[model samples]
Target: MEKEKAHESQNSKLTHENRFGLGSSEHVSIEHDPDDLWGDSRVIVNIGPTHPAMHGALRMVAKLNGETIESSYCQFGYTHRAKEKLGENRTYHQFVVYTDRLNYCSSLLNNVVYAMAVERLMGIEVPPRCTWIRMICCELARVIDHLICIGINAVDLGAFSYFLYGFHQREEAYTLIEKLCGARLTTSYTRIGGLMYDAPDGWEKEVKDWVVRTRKVIDEMDRLLTTNKIWCDRTQGVAIFTKEDCLSYSYSGPNARAAGIDIDLRRDQPCLFYRDVEFDVPIAKEGDVYARYRVRLEEIRQSLNIVAQCADKVKKGPIWSEDKRVKIPDKTLVHNTMEGMIHHFKFFMTGFDVPEGEAYTTFEAANGELGFYIVSKGAPRAHRMRIRGPSVYHYQGLDLMVRGEKIADLVAALGSINIIAGELDR
Candidate 1:
């Protein structure tokens, strides 16, 4: 009884201290909404953790009046795995694996961002071929992710055939990814200075074949949904947000593109091999769900174009640099030479040291600006690492979109936002 009381007292004291901390109490109170105690509202609808259209374990308490939403509140943390806390305990390389969990639809991009940020902090220079390969693979991932988003949105809007067709193409893309990397969904293929391994022999031909097949699939998807009267009626002019509004909310990628903001990190920031490549950024004037859908579909074409360019420009060269500090020495050399063996052992065990600096690297992810902010205290492991996820921003804009719109449109709006809960909760 005494121990229980002491425990409670300790918790209370901690809570009191936390409440008084700088900006902590203010943020907590806003998130918790203590005034929601009465549960009194007109036509309250709870769409939730178990709902088919909810995507992941997310709940939205919406108040409506005859097909018009008055106000809405989102509930998260159901799928939270304490990713930030988990990063603190793991080594730099081990943390790369955890990044696969965030925005699992485009896990490769997440891993790339994490690795790139670390590389920046470490001042490690990757090979040109590796950078180009990362760009190509991440662009492919963007297309795959958009297919899921647009197709799923169509499904929610009662177009089942489109979903099947899109997913079919996505599966083909997945197979290609699986062939390139050992794993499809969770591809930790990227290392500090280069890939885990070079693209397999004849991988270029495989990429070409997939591009041809995907172009056909894209044509079929367009015919099935893009020009269909039902699809147009359901999506056009629904859940609109302007360019200014999106910018104010820190929106990025397709969401921003849909609002006529022509900002693609690949073009504007020019990271990796993006500067050498040529591709168009598709933009739509209308910020409706349909506009977002159209932007994504057009983006698939751009990605295919980039893949073709990469295939043509790609040369037979070393994928990894000759930096012993960043990359392990060749196995043949390690076995035959003492110096090579020593270099390999040192890299694997101690890892390389990073410069004492911070860098913020942003990439054009499937959803939006997937950013990684890393602060290195001159250690192999980062002093601090933060992920800037699009889903969180998308979730923040949900109330604005859903309110005053039909309950049925909720699913369409949510799908268009492409709020993968993994990214949101993380």
Candidate 2:
């Protein structure tokens, strides 16, 4: 009882002196108590709408008690491109370019998912070769995205050399993408009913060779970064989110898998050549920054396996559906005949019509279960289009994840989740 009274007295003595309006200065002066560890240490810190550690245009408003975040909330939409709104205004084929901007780190994944959604609406199934080629592209994109995520995560944590190892592989992957489509960062390779172009003659062999080289680099990175004392100390047990927290926030993909959720859309809800291929989904129960990194690292290896399998399965065949309604006219036919030229002009000008029905297609994209919800009214464009980017849901949990963690851990948590601003703010 005496100790309780003494503690109350100490708290009473530590009240802010400026609460009674006794000062002209804006600063609040608190009476220091020797027993109080947080005396005058609580303050609000804004971590970015423009900061390097943020990875993108993410703003974290945190209330800090010394070095630890007492409470926090995140803010986004600094780069609102209104991608969904643009979908309604443009034809389905034209919107493929917009999807690329969502998760630019793996634009091919976005391209594939959007095309799948449109194809489902039209009841079109692309050829076997196209399906196998898409699987390879999706897996390659997955590796590229994971590499960027893990590499950037390391960069934020002061592992500069670690990023370089994955970065070289990413550049090689981008070169392959460039060969498939003329563009690198914003690749609109998938048309509504098929691919913009078929893989080059030696593309499969090149992809297999790249995968082999990537495997070696990944192993080297694992040896260098996994057991490093500084990395473990900084990441291991920091920013933990329980499985319940992840489910509550609608988390999917590696971020959810790291939190002990074993759901992968490719395994549970198979699409395209996913049912035919074999790849393991990596899971971790710790749900910390380190666990997320490890999951992505393992996923990269699995992606390599998928790419190799797909390279073997892919054969020379038609890469487009037989649906004349959605198919683009051949270049030779367009140049030789007036009928083909008119058809080609019409295809580009009016676009292809989808049936009067709604379809939502979700794919196991690099980050998570990326879904596209399209409502069609049998027109050239969708009546309404909604994109379910994983970054938005993952970003929502940042406040809960960062509370009681050090400010530096916030950087680790944000990078670990790999929130691309284009996806988050779209």
Candidate 3:
């Protein structure tokens, strides 16, 4: 028909590349065909590998019909350092620093989890004091991670003050970390069979005080956002990823729990001192942006309780295992004695060997299930090392989650998931 031919001709002109070598020029655009609702109306939009709304070096390309996203694809690896490959080449001790870069917001959890995986493979049981301290560190890291997640989620939805409420507490938590390891953001605090050092004198008390302040701040954040009309409008019933969809995409942690998946590795698969601690796993059935926000807020409270319990229970004792092969010589001895200096140099250069074995260790990290799979052929370095970061799986679900939603909702959903580029592209 003549009409069909005319439509085809118009589309061809619209498809032509612009003079500037970008997409089709608007000057050559065509009107929509009567037969097709989306003809010439759908446009492609690139959200970001470098957009402000995007939390990290993540890109989402979407085809849009007006303001609604018709379909989308997420691309990552912009900040990839091939962390797993680095794990293979670097000594187990050296690789601890690399873990810090994974989820830099809560680097301590990554450090603890990586160390735990290597320790399990070596058949080393760290002392009780060490185990308890690791648990406290993990909980503190979880709190900081969740605070940033929800706070930033609010800021994305136009609640800047709400972010500051949690951020102040985040800084307080960092001070405690500094006291423990002399570093704040990327504190490489956990060592193979021990920590960098035991908590400095009165560090536990400071942690407890931080917890008390954080709880009040959390309550304030809940009051500020949970019932506010605009916040509810932006988040409630938006980007609803069902429980079935979550399972299909391998969702874990708060994101999965928000969809009514009653899984918390810390509870279901108890590791370290998880079995000894008393805490609750928060769950929500709605699975909307609001539900995800609520889940994280509640998680922060639970982590606070865990930190308090740890502070009360942790007592003075050896923080490292007696295993000479894994333990680092004391700093004072290493500096003062010639034999100690030589031992230290050899340890750093050659590294200790692990037994010929393989082990996969999973922990309930801040974002979700963080796992380290190690295959060792009795070498100082891993034969093969793989990290299973939750962001990879969570990011995969983004396309499905954003389909049919407005472009603004994409920002909300992405922030709620807390996609870390290091872990995602690893």
Show the colliding residue pairs in model 2. Answer: none
lDDT of 3 by residue, 1-426 (tens): 999988876665445434335464555445544544444457899878999889989999999887788899989999999888998999999999999999998899999999999989988999988988999999999999998999898899899999999899999888899889999998999999998888888888888988898888888889988999999999998999999999999999999999999999999999888888899999999999999999999999999999999999999999999999888998898999998998899899999998889998999999899999999999999999999999999999999999999999999999999998888887
Using TM-score as the measure, the top candidate is 2
Q: How many clashes does each candidate structure show, in the order listed?
A: 0, 0, 0
Give candidate 1 misplaced runs (Cα > 4 Å). Answer: 1-41, 332-350
- Residues 1-426, model 2: lDDT tens digits: 999987875555445344544445443354454544555557899988999899889898999877788899889999999998999999998998999999988889999999999999888999999999888989999999999999999999999999999999999999998999988899989998899999988999999999999999999999999999999999999999999999999999999999999999999998897888888999999999999999999999999999999999999999999999999999999999999999999998998888899988999888888999999998998899999999999999988999989888999999999999988888
lDDT of each: 0.83, 0.91, 0.90
lDDT of 2: 0.91
- lDDT of candidate 1 over 1-426, digit per residue (tens): 999976775565456556667345454344322322222236889999779899888999998765668899999988888777766555576677889889988888887888788777767778777877787788778888888899888888899988998899889888888888889898887877778888888887888888888999999889888889988988898999888889888888999899999899889987778888889999999999999999999998999989878877777777776766677678999999998888877776766677788888888888988888877777766677788888999889988877778889999899998989999998
TM-score of each: 0.87, 0.92, 0.91
* Total clashes in model 1, counting residue pairs 3 or more apart in sequence or in different chains: 0
**Ranking 1 against 2 by lDDT, winner:** 2
Clashes of 3: 0
